[model samples]
Target chain A: MSDFIEKFSSISLNDIKNVPESDFPELTAEEKALASQAVTYSNRIEDADSISNLNDSLRNKTFIVGNKPSKADLLVFEKVFKVASKWSSVEDVSKHRHIIRWVDLIQNTLVNVPESEKLKVSLDIEVPREIKE
Target chain B: MVVTLTVAAKAPLVPYGSLIATEFVNRSNGDGKIDLQVVDQKSVDSADANSASKLTTSDGKEIKGEADVLKELGKLFPDVLQEVSKSQDLIDTAQNNLSIKNFKELATHLEKLDAHLNFRSFMLFHKCTVADIAVWGVLRANALMGSIIKNEVYVNVSRWYNFLAADERFDAAIQNFTKSLAELKKSEKLSKGKKESHKA
Candidate 1:
């Protein structure tokens, strides 16, 4: 699995809360910086031109990370594809054919191979160890 | 056609569903041309399961992803293409701007949005387009930044926001989501209390 997929798998829904502070996993300084950059990249998605530019840039690539759809593709897709329909038109999609192809691949595979099915098959969530007195 | 849109009440992307529902309602004008029903999935997991954009068409075609649904909608209403497409840019900008963790950066975005709203009631033309719905829905769905909106941080955006808040369609779209979220939180607290009592 890719680094993001591993890290994201470690995080449970409990880690996400309305209130800021929570028992999230410890991250290295580099990971923290990457998180910040992700936020910036997420923000940039609001601009159609910026997204179009990104799509154009990624036209040659099969996915954002590796040939297969990784958590990286999912993350970016959540931000871009989630809101693309509400804002983007046919023209925009035609302009960014690569993005559409990438989005379709993820959406299709994700539906066919549901995450719940994966969790059912694997014991990914760790149990808490007993505390030492 | 009957379209069912399911979403988590508090999901960050909730606004997308709400905005689309708002547009459908406004354009339909009780003509029954489109029947869009917004369903709130209380649990976060259930919401995330089909979070993209879960739209079941009249013919039982389950379509996921925000882009896919909008494309379908655009095909039905060709005039909405330009407005919806333009609104995507504004919505994207708002999502990024709203994610600004630093106050300084947030203020800069607020100023820009305020200026955009200056002397304008809606984001695009004189009428309420998908752009207005998208921007308004984003800010409204986000309670943290929603404070800025409620506090009237940006004069023009606030004014425009208030105008939409009073709209029947806008209010109608949010009424159920707000109520469902509150109920979900209440049940969560109850369940937490039960767990604590069991431990005690």
Candidate 2:
């Protein structure tokens, strides 16, 4: 029973989704897209252009690359927070209102994230409480 | 100037308290990066130990105290706590204890540290902290300690002190202070010899 738990525990949701469709029929194409998008954006988290793109995508969404919280959001937030945490200037943060809202939601929602694991973004850009069309 | 250097590089933070990477640290000690122009307010009485060292910040703010100087320098870094190494509270006590000129109190400080050294290898931890550096720096600058520390009065302190003195990190700062003092003494002797020749 312990051996079964250890084997399954090591296999995260990300690993299951990444295997070939034949190996795992439960893996949906949309979930694959979400995880892939997270990897792509996380790789370029340093580029300002990628930050703006992330801003646009996160306008109506709560998380970065998924409908709800998952490893996808965790992946991007870990990288993006390191970059966005440095955006202290009014002009810098205000340029991407969506990012501020998303960063705020992600940071406030995540409970177990240790300070050493990821940096917390600290800026006041007057972001609206709710997203408006 | 970027403050809070590894006490590892410089043997002791000079008498002014902490290493400020000042231009005044002679050519050999000046690392170019941390060097800043320090206007040393030449106190009238050179023997006056109570006079506080002062630093004029880039913003024209006056900062005093060795601990405060280190923290102010730490603020220059993105993460102050990460940059400034631990046991500042320990260093603070060392700074105050060493600054006491009275022989009775000075011995007490030495005795306390000697006792503490009995329990741990270093001042506060298994490894060297700024407390060790700060205390060592203060002792290094005091002429009386040079003679007193030579004898095994505080055996634990002498052992720990010798260990720190051997480290190459503290060598640069130690050499800087020692060299400057030697130069000053040499120049004084030369001037005295000239005066005697003129009289003869």
Candidate 3:
């Protein structure tokens, strides 16, 4: 079970690195097409600048929804932190007040396991390089 | 306003929550749209499980239990379930609760369940409806667990996962989530190996 959860955690992280236009690998035909469509859809709803701003604003709080913490934050936090750390562009955008507050909330309140233990579990796993393009 | 289903941190429903939201939204036909909101349920203090249980939908609808949702979705979207069952290896790799020998049996049952989904004249609606999204979430979580175990048998499942990952909307929301998980583990490993080297 721990193995499964650990692996799940790793896969989630890998997915963050696979996003379009993050200096990650170029998208395959399908990914590119899908990404283009999403960009269009997102654009139709709101501009990139606004979306970026929204993300920045949302980052600082300890909770993403409701008066208390929820699972959605756990799933999203791991990825947001990774993206913010790995990509300079993402980091720049994530440095907004909301994002910082949210991250701080997660860091201070949400984290249940010891940081060292988490780091240890993460270190034990091996990441495969050959993710399908 | 769009109706969204946000998950709490450490909630068991996190894996399948978005898929369920997608299914609900797809089926709502824009009537009562279901937007997926992934919350950090883990932030809720451990002692607050009872309080967490009381959390409701944006409109105050209580989220259904996992089993109930799965059964309902299974009845609604049989075809998607069939597609998911086709990736047997992926199913086998998700968790150790099930034995390896049960893979074939599970696959067989999944096929039957798929058939049930496809049974058009059986009074249920046709096509991939919101119910399919529910089942899809379960299958997807199982496959995710399998992939992490490095189960080689799940190659076909991997193929299917890649196909889903290629989609922009799905990717936009889920890609970051999965990738961060993978990296967190990797960074831990690198740091640990370094520590061991110093100790040596």
Q: Write the per-residue lDDT of candidate 2 for residues B46-165, one digit (tens) a residue.
A: 354333343445456755555665544444431211224565666577667875667897887876666554323346433344456567767776656776666747654665666566
Question: What is model 1's DockQ versus the real complex?
Answer: 0.01
Which candidate, 1 or 2, would have the higher TM-score against the true structure?
A: 1
Which of the two, 2 or 3, has more TM-score?
A: 2
Decreasing TM-score order of the candidates:
1, 2, 3
Alpha-carbon TM-score of each model against the true structure: 0.46, 0.43, 0.32
Q: Is the docking of candidate 3 incorrect, acceptable, medium or high quality?
A: incorrect
- Return the clash pairs for model 2, or none: B8-B169, B9-B169, B10-B170, B11-B170
Lowest-scoring 10 consecutive residues by lDDT in candidate 2 chain A? A1-10
Range of the 10 consecutive residues with the lowest summed lDDT in candidate 3 chain B? B117-126
In candidate 1, what are the lDDT values of residues B3-56, reduced to their tens digit? 665455545456454444534555553533444444445323453453544556
Fnat for the candidates in order? 0.00, 0.00, 0.00
Q: Is candidate 1 or candidate 3 better by TM-score?
A: 1
Q: Give the TM-score (0 to 1) of chain B in model 2.
A: 0.63
lDDT of 3 at A83: 40
Q: Score the docking of each candidate (DockQ).
A: 0.01, 0.01, 0.01
Ranking by lDDT: 1, 2, 3
- Winner on lDDT between 2 and 3 is 2
Q: Model 2, residue A52: what's the lDDT?
A: 81
Candidate 1 lDDT (Cα, whole model)?
0.51
Best by TM-score: 1
